[model samples]
Target: MIPRAVSKNGYAVLNAEDPLVYKMKELVDGRVVCFSMDENNPTIKRRAERGRVSCVYENGYVTILKGKWKVRVEKASNIPLTYGGRAEFMIQNVLAATLACFVHGISIEDIRVGLTTFNAGTAQTPGRLNFIEVGSCTVLMDYAHNPAGFSGLVNFISKLPNKYRTVVINVPGDRRNDDIREMGEIAGNNFDRIVIRAGHYLRGRDASDIAALIQEGINRTGKEPQVRIIPESRDAIQHAIKYARKGELVVTLADIVPDDISHVQEIRDQILKKQQATEV
Candidate 1:
């Protein structure tokens, strides 16, 4: 249905690295412009060799290859969303978005400005890896609920400086048991500590039941991290942030993004006030 929906002149932005998504290239009714994090991807390479258009992450830049012409939109390090080129998923996102804009006749300089100017953690997009610092603790708030979403967060976390990483996860009650479990397993495998927040929009599942299911999956990993369930999201956030020391990270997969961000912002404000008082 996807390919069939496109007119012959329409553009289909496809991912060459994803086998399933790349397969759509064969079926697309419109012109296909592929993007990939791998510059040397066989399909993308072949497209470049044949004088076709492709976007790739070559060296440090998000480069567009138009037959021998290399147009670099921006370096991943310069783009705040990619988190200093460490967030591999964001790199792919940048590639796709840059290619989409380019095909629509957006200039390279405009694309570069957009990439460098867009800050995901601002008030406009607070639930996207917004960091709040309180003394030694680095608290991150994001709205990662599903397995894939948590997996992306985990990928970003892996790129962060070595620290005692603890994730305060809140799985939506409405998701499938498998999805919740998968998120739990991902957190278990990656984080050093896990705090499960049981509140808001649990659908039909009981709070305890939801927490237990996640803990069950975490048990499968044989990791040392233990599961603790907090019935209140605020308390869960506090618990995760309170005990963190220097060189430690506290990640909160928020159930309510606004509430979570506001709560952390207040915490940060209090800490800043106390620090100022101490200096005086």
Candidate 2:
């Protein structure tokens, strides 16, 4: 749909770092604008070789390079949506949107303003890196269920400077057992502690089945992660919060967005109340 929409003299923005984006360019009949993390990525080089119209990237700064006109905007760290540039995937999104606007003849000043002001909160982008702070700990709540999403989150989590890390996670029963284990493996690699919980809405597998598969993945990592099997999602969250310490980062990989979000928020409120009492 994207390639066809821009097939008729319209501008198309592609992720120059993604190999699939290069194939997608074949479907696009108009000028292909590209965005990438690095300016020297093979896809970006390929796009340039193919005479693509424009490209946006971060080579120390958010830069847009076209044929003869070049515009360098504020660094991604200044953009709230990029989470101080820790969310590398979001930085790619910002690049794509910026390049698309540039193709549409939007002023560089306007694009810069939009990039700086754009906010990604629970309301703005729910179930995707909703950072919640309770006292001194930072809790990241996300609904990353697939391998790709988990991989992206693992990268972001690795960059967080925390004394300890905990992950409350579950995968849907409908997914292949291997896939569920892979998610666990990824979490195990990054987190110091882990809680395997039921998603509360399993897509039709017996209780403990999915959790067991995830455990298999966790154990395969060879890292002696402090592990727990809490079947209920809410209970798992409560367990995580109970043992959470200051400077620790708790990541909840929720399967059901709405239910998990409500439960997390409730836990956050409880933590706040406890903190208030301690302060008193």
For 197-223, candidate 2 gives per-residue lDDT tens digits of: 877658789758888888889888999
Write down the TM-score for model 2.
0.86
What is the clash tally of candidate 2? 0
Query: What 10-residue stretch in candidate 1 is worst by lDDT?
Result: 120-129
What TM-score against the true fold does each predicted structure earn? 0.87, 0.86
Residues 9-45 of candidate 1: C-alpha lDDT, one tens digit per residue:
8888888988888788788778999998888899988
Best by lDDT: 1
- The lDDT for every candidate, in the order shown, is 0.84, 0.80
Screening candidate 2 with a backbone cut-off below 3 angstroms (N, C-alpha, C), the clashing residue pairs are none
